[model samples]
Target: MPRSIRRRPGLAAALALLAAAAPAATAQQVVIYRCTDASGALTVQNDEPCPAGSREERAIIEPPPPMPVYVPQAPAPAPVTSRATQAAAATTPAVPERPEAPAPARIADADRLPPPPIFRCHTPGNDRYISEDAEPKPRCVPLQTVGINGDPSLGAGAACEWQYDRCERIPDGEACDGWRQRGREIESTWRYARGDARAPLQDAFARVSTILSDTTCGLPPG
Candidate 1:
């Protein structure tokens, strides 16, 4: 304690010297000037007045200000929803009812009939009669209706054959000529046929009409 107290005065003296030296250092650091003399000789000095303005240049150096530092803050957290809010959302009104779709159209069942039996009957004169009715004769046999949908060529040939049969049935004169002319007319339509059943069916029925027209055969009303 005694030695520390003795050193205090020396420390105080040193601090006083530093304080006095501060102003002297500041004065030394002032702007410097370059002055030209009467003989055009240049002289450089610190903080002194130029001699009668022969020419003077002063340079002051100062340090630039320090840049400011920026620190980014974190974003605030999102608010949490309470359980009551979730329950209220769940209790909202139910969605509007959707309209019912229209019922599908009801389809009517097809009107059905049993197919008529076709019979083949033979006469005593060795002639054969193909009938659509059930003949009680011993030589009569049932036959199925022929389907001509498979081959269009076969259908056309059958149509021509039916026409010839009709021509044979008619009297061999102007009446048969009429039937022949009808055949020729129907044959002309064959050129325009477009792979349909109508043309051949039409020709076959036209021939069948002559046979059905004969009243002497005692056939039922066509």
Candidate 2:
């Protein structure tokens, strides 16, 4: 016997009821608007109106990008070159320019000049002597030999003594004509008197003056 086709009426009717049920549409929801004015002041109202003097730009939310699949690249080959080429490639990178050093200081010679020459005479003489180094005795001598005069002995001692005495009375404001210098010492015989009376002393002063001026004569006793 063939299997009879089984059909349930009640099950078919329940399926029809389920197919007839329909969902209702939700009411158009009013969106309360909120915005800021051009001066950045906040504004809120029930009705939708574009904010005054401010353009409205739509705000967008972005999703993050997907993670990338990593694929390793092949290693680069080492470079091969001639020695000259390698040397050119090996040049050091340029360095930043540095400020120039200040110029070396220059010192003036006046700052290190030597002191002036110092010279002082040291000899044995009072205010009268030219310096400390001068002969002590009066420079006078008697003329031993008579000149073309009639007699040498006649006017000899008296005239000689008178002439030499002039040394005791050296004339004021009269400078001696001759002077002798030996090393730092000076010696000189000045005319004490005029006329024949002082002839001997004058002759003596002349001799002493000569010795003083002589380069060969050494410094005499003070």
- TM-score of each candidate? 0.17, 0.15
Per-model clash counts, in order, read: 0, 8
Worst 10 residues of 2 by lDDT: 161-170
Model 1: weakest 10-residue lDDT segment is 159-168
Q: Tens digit of lDDT per residue, candidate 1, span 95-188?
A: 4222222332232223222222333444545554333334342433432334467643444322211111111232322333343344444444
Q: Distance from true position, residue 138, model 2, in Å?
A: 12
| lDDT by residue for model 2 (142-190), tens | 4455545756665444322211111122222221221322111221222
Every candidate's lDDT: 0.43, 0.36
Candidate 2, residue 142: lDDT: 46
Badly placed stretches (over 4 Å) of model 2 are 1-126, 130-192, 213-222
Residue 7, model 2, lDDT: 31
Output the number of the TM-score-best candidate. 1
Q: Candidate 2: deviation at residue 59, Å? A: 99
lDDT of 2 at 11: 36
